[model samples]
Target: MGWLKMPLREGVAALQNSIVSELQRNWPALVTLTPDLLGLEYPGETTLDFLEAIRDLTDSGMVTCEAIIISSNDGPRMVDAALTARGRAMFEPKGRAAA
Candidate 1:
């Protein structure tokens, strides 16, 4: 199963895209380290669904964000599960599992 995660946004505009896209566009530096996500404030794209477009890339192993492309010190980052829940595996509620 894919790792479920989300970026810590301060307001509405930052949370525009899903978390997956954030991983791909900012790569090589930000990296797909698994269980350790790079955090950064996300910017908006004019011609793309930044999050939905590359949702599957992260599961393949690696994904990057555009922010990491230009800078060495990136901020908060978003993740895939919060993006669209496309590859997430769900089970019964935790409380019910013990029953």
Candidate 2:
């Protein structure tokens, strides 16, 4: 399925995976979510949809967004976002100490 066309759970999972991957690549640095980083055009998705996906990550103790600004034109702007240890674990190879 397309990025935004997936079921809500799967879409959120995909979004989380993307966020984790980018954060993992940068390691010690944080990210500010941009359209380029997000890399998807959620045509039918709303700001709440974006926020809900992000909320899922934060609620699961996976990642953190220091500043989440709701843009009137855009959606949510996730500033200074970073993965937690748990989020990093998602990228670990199988059999590695991911927990």
Candidate 3:
């Protein structure tokens, strides 16, 4: 059987979409980024990849990183993330009344 493959851009897009969807569902609440949690969400992605994606989103002002959790050894561990106004505007569907 031939192996199925996705282009790099498409894979990245899917990851981004998953992140946006999670944030949309947890709107107004910060989502903690842990390796295990990320793994559960995007099984194919590595922790470093997720971090890079989060960094890209932050750079674009699509999301905000509240805090960077560090280990006692002074290494970065996880990040606390939340969607920004711009992110919400882009991800949230239009013409929906706020409950």
The model with the greatest lDDT is: 2
Candidate 1: segments with Cα more than 4 A from true spot = 1-28, 31-48, 64-99
**lDDT of all predictions:** 0.32, 0.71, 0.65
The sequence of per-residue lDDT tens digits that candidate 3 reaches over residues 1-99 is 865543344355666777888777888777876545544433334544665666667767898876766453433444568888888877778887433
Compare candidates 2 and 3 on TM-score and give the better one: 2
**Ordered list by lDDT, greatest first:** 2, 3, 1
Question: Which model, 1 or 2, shows the larger TM-score?
Answer: 2
In model 3, the Cα lDDT at residue 23 comes to 75
lDDT comparing candidate 2 with the true structure: 0.71
Residue pairs in candidate 2 whose N, alpha carbon or C atoms collide under 3 angstroms: none
Name model 2 segments beyond 4 Å from true.
1-10, 46-48, 95-99
Q: Comparing 1 and 3 by TM-score, which wins?
A: 3
CA lDDT of 97 in candidate 1? Answer: 33
What TM-score goes with each of the models? Answer: 0.20, 0.71, 0.65
lDDT of 3 at 90: 73
**With candidate 1 superimposed using the best TM-score fit, by how many Å does residue 37's alpha carbon deviate from the native?**
18
Tens digit of per-residue lDDT, candidate 2, span 24-96: 7786888887544677664446444567777777877888878887765765678998888877776676787
Per-residue C-alpha lDDT of model 1 across residues 1-99, encoded as one tens digit per residue: 977655423432232333434432442234432212323233433212333333333443333334312222442233222321222222123454311
